[model samples]
Target: MMPKKAENCISCAVKLTGTGFTRFPCPDCGEVIGRCAKCRGQSNPYKCPKCGFIGP
Candidate 1:
């Protein structure tokens, strides 16, 4: 089963709030990942907590 969406940004560990935050499944593990708008805009890399899959 797919993992639930994270409440904090995976890249920066910031609480996910307001608009522009995003949640999507990890390509390797189907685990949900969360990203804040700042991190996404900066192209910061994030690692999946479940499978260690990293992405830009």
Candidate 2:
């Protein structure tokens, strides 16, 4: 099954709001991943909570 979309930034656990936050599907598990502007700008690595898939 497709995983639910993440509500907060995966790397920082910050609430996603305003501009620059992104939501995309995990490459490995099709789970939605969330990234805040700061983390995305820094290229922080995020793990898919459902499948253990990590990406930067």
Candidate 3:
């Protein structure tokens, strides 16, 4: 089996690339989340899919 790659940016819905996405755990549930470089740089708000908690 292969490791799953990020499919899209959680904030902007942009297609993700190997070097353009950042992966981190959701603060509430510890679920992995993916954010694109552009959004991260711009401080775009992201919601946790597992808990619906929103944050920058």
Candidate 4:
């Protein structure tokens, strides 16, 4: 098996990767394990970068 790659990474835009500390999101907090261009980072006092919706 080989690693995956993006052909148009520069052209392609990702709103959020949703990859946090763990693969699964917090059941109570709804935290995700990913990167948000808007948020810069994930977790604690988290909010939706796309909509500014704060996490519970």
Candidate 5:
């Protein structure tokens, strides 16, 4: 069977799968960033440390 994995970060659109996984949207789940990659590194998603330059 195929294992299920996070596909997109609720904050940033960074692929929660392969290559993009290197970086994560929310360091952990249950959190939201309300941003995207192009806006930062990914898109329609968040990077990390929402308390940083990231947005609300």
Candidate 6:
């Protein structure tokens, strides 16, 4: 069993199951960002507020 952690989708800010999200390192910084499956499936663009980097 796994805990249901909450995480905000980087592309849409929707609350998603942490286990259902994807974590990747920011290209500009080493910080990690979380993207939900819905956003990733739709190729939604996301902007990293910390580094101002935008991408799908």
Give the clash count for each candidate: 0, 0, 0, 6, 11, 0
For candidate 2, lDDT tens digit of each residue in 1-56?
53366789999999999999999998997888999999999999999989899898
Off by more than 4 A, model 3: 1-5
- What Cα-based lDDT does every candidate model obtain? 0.90, 0.90, 0.80, 0.34, 0.40, 0.71
Best by TM-score: 2
Q: Estimate TM-scores for all models.
A: 0.88, 0.90, 0.77, 0.26, 0.21, 0.72
Clashes of 1: 0
Candidate 3 local lDDT, 1-56, one digit each (tens)? 32254477889878778686798887897767789999999989999777898988
lDDT of 5 by residue, 1-56 (tens): 31233445445455554342333334454333433344445333334443344433
For the record, the alpha-carbon RMSD of candidate 2 to the native fold, in angstroms, is 2.5
**What lDDT tens digits, residue by residue, belong to model 1 across residues 1-56?**
44376888998889999999999989998888999999999999999898899899
On the 0 to 100 scale, the lDDT of residue 54 in model 4 is 51
Clashing pairs for model 3 are: none
- Measured on C-alpha atoms, candidate 5 has an lDDT of 0.40
State, as a TM-score between 0 and 1, how close model 6 is to the true structure.
Answer: 0.72
lDDT (Cα) of model 2: 0.90
Q: For all the candidates, what are their Cα RMSDs to the real structure?
A: 2.8, 2.5, 3.7, 10.1, 7.9, 6.2
Instruction: Flag clash pairs in model 4.
Output: 18-33, 18-34, 19-33, 19-34, 20-33, 20-34
Instruction: Find the 10 residues in a row with the least total lDDT in model 3.
Output: 1-10
* TM-score of structure candidate 4: 0.26
lDDT of 5 at 16: 55
Candidate 1 vs 2: which has more TM-score: 2
Model 4 lDDT tens row, 1-56: 32123211111234334442223343454433333334343333544333345543
lDDT of 4: 0.34
Clashes of 2: 0
Point out where model 6 deviates above 4 Å: 1-6
Q: Where in model 5 is the C-alpha error above 4 Å?
A: 1-5, 18-56
What would the per-residue lDDT of candidate 6 be over residues 26-55, giving only the tens digit for each residue? 798655677898888888887765777887
